[model samples]
Target: MKKTWKRLNLIAAACGILVMSAGQAQAMGLLQAYEAALINDPTYRAAVSENTAGKEFRNIGRSGLLPTLQYVYGSGKNRAEITQPATNFLGQPTGGFAVSNYDYTSITNSLSLRQVLFSLDATARYKQGIAQTNYSDAIFSARSKDLVIRLTTAYADVKFAEDQLDLYHAQRDALDEQRRINARMFEKGEGTKTDMLETQAKLDVAEAQVIEAQDNLLNARNAFSAIVGSEVTQLDGLRAEFTVMPAKQTSFEEWMTVATENNPEIAAAKYSLEAAELEISKAKAGHTPRLDLNAGYNRGLSDSITTRTQDQTIKSIGVQLVIPIYAGGYVNAISAQAVANRDKARADLDSTRNRIAIELRRQFNALQTSLTKISALQKSVNSSTLLVEATKQSVKGGVRINLDVLSSEQQLVAAKRDLAQAKYNYLISFLKLRVAAGTISIDDIQTVAAYFSPMS
Candidate 1:
């Protein structure tokens, strides 16, 4: 029982450390998420790991330029036998005598070192490793930008759902009030039952809208949670913002220039081109001669009993050179393949830049369109507000029918909805333009959120 408590404490400590880790962060904004993801994201981390492993090629190449040292030792015992005629210094051939030794011991030890003078393959691979590292760094930056776009879309959806839900509630309340007024009029024999029924039916439709809005909100919340690695249970609306977006200072061409220069996709493609060039150089390096130096030491000890025994030690040092002889043209074929691949990489980069420019044009136009719609819609709302008031007064003067007032109110609701949609479109278009301008940073997202602060 005491051991169980100790184990539980240990487990809790581990969990605490895990939560404190950079990658385990809770809900974060787009920029915060970008920072956290750059630190914690598995794919980027894996690329970093691969980059680190690739760097070992530097050491491997440098090894050929450095010395290799070695030491060795051995000991052994053996038996030997010898037969000879036994004679003194006087050279007396007395009789055949034999001397047999049971055992003898031997020991040996040695050390040696060697270094290479020239190796083109090693030089090329070392340079390639440096290039690969740079490539991986560029890829990491691109991934973070991608995360920003994904999270922005998800966050916007949540806000849209929230706004739709609010509209439903507002419309529903307005209809409920109408139904109550109509009910009172009918009781007084001043209004028809049909009027009450119509208001009630509209209220029911608004309630259904609320239900659908709730479902959309839930789905948006889930998407955000998946991206930010945290559950989103609460959402704050941007309420204070009720204005048209200002026009852009720069033209579409200038925006495209900025996007092409700073966008991550273009940067990634540039790096890929560099990597392919390096690979081509690497493959061609295979045709070059490689030089290496190796050294070894060995020692042995032996004991022999019989005729004779001896112990010995051995040492050796050497330099080796390998020139490509022939391998069914594999080297040439690979080098040619690398060249073709480099051409493909370059072409891919061109295609990517073109696609990016097209998107920038589309999004820029969309932003401009949204801004124009917002200005027009603002004017429409003001006119519609006056029209609604005029219609109500006419009804009081017995010059307008009740149905006419209801129709104007319906038009007002529709205009307000159109305004809501305009706001949504403007929000989305502004973000798109920022994305095109390579200004899709967390600060830009926060700026959007700030526009809604008045409502908050």
Candidate 2:
């Protein structure tokens, strides 16, 4: 039974390995992933479908203002019974009655036309449709730009996760080598038993951290795959040497003005307000009069019982006017409701403006701060590298212990990790700032992509 269990475990492990290998056949670059997402992303596809449907609103609204024509043809059988008083031959009193029966087929055809001459309701609805269509366009534009930001964020997250895992593994390897060194020195009477125990403890902790980092990396990869609709085994990495750029706009006020003018969300909200105003107009129009031109033609064969064998044709044209007197107070109530809704829309527009301003400030400030953070971390990494080497030399000369060397190595690894984190943060902040300003585009993405080199 034990041997059978062992065989099952081995088979399961082999299957997992095979699945992983098949899941990631090639490395995906940022641009390639973005292209794949554009085609495969469900969210973006939904936006496209919504935009397509929204454009039909105009047609629907205009239908009320157009002329309508209809034709009707009907055929049926008709039967009638007639009764009359009977008279005697000499015109004397006659009480008897006579009856006659007749049967025939009747056919009729009609053509009618109605053209609306005036309708406030129809006009308001047409305007509303235009506003709604504009709103849809703005929303689609916002969503399209959001896709770029979302994709870049996911890409950055995966890269950071990979960086974390690599750093942890490096730390683990350093600890493991120190453990071996301590063991050898203790055996040769050059190191103390305490040194060996300490190195072993650090190695154990480093191994646990490595395990956690691996789990994080797996999760990040899964999230990225969900967006790109495919598993990615590798990705491009940031160049070893690159320059950090500064924000172009000098003042926060300038950014705020730009966002107000260019932000798709704000535009959508304004359109919503316009549509709401039109709704108020439409509701009030319910109390107004309507006028239309009406024309019709009719033809009949065997028209009625009295003209059973006669055929007739009639054509008429006239104008119609309709004035609303009362509708159980529905019109007034609906108009008031529309007014309230319009107020709500106004409030929503204001709220959106405030929220956007807050986000714009946060991303702008973060982008500025990241430049300084990256510069500081770069220097820290450089100094940490030198410190690690110096500590190792001191240990070889009997001036420092194994523990000192281990600490210095750990510090160096930490500095490198921090530097990598800062770089990723800077890139994300820069992109987010652009998103907040409503200026994010493919060119911005391409520029960012240029900062990375494909992993060999």
Which candidate number has the best TM-score?
2
* Local lDDT at 246 for model 1: 60
User: In candidate 1, where is summed lDDT lowest over 10 consecutive residues?
Assistant: 301-310
Q: Runs in model 2 with CA error above 4 Å?
A: 1-24, 75-106, 178-205, 302-310, 388-410
TM-score of 1: 0.68
What does each candidate score in C-alpha RMSD?
9.2, 10.3
- Give one digit per residue, the lDDT tens place, for model 2 in 24-132: 5467777677666665578977997998899878887888889999999999998899897876889764898878899999999999999999999999998899899
Cα displacement (angstroms), candidate 1, residue 306, comes to: 14
Candidates in order, TM-scores: namely 0.68, 0.83
- In candidate 2, what residue range of length 10 has the lowest lDDT sum? 1-10
For each predicted model, how many residue pairs clash, with residues at least 3 apart or on different chains? 32, 0
Off by over 4 Å in 1: 1-116, 170-207, 239-249, 295-318, 384-446, 454-456
Q: Candidate 2: how many backbone clashes?
A: 0
How many clashing pairs in candidate 1?
32
- Candidate 1 per-residue lDDT over residues 333-450, each given as its tens digit: 9889989988998999999899888888888787778777877877887788888899899989999866566666666766666776777667777777766566565555556666
Candidate lDDT values, in order = 0.66, 0.83
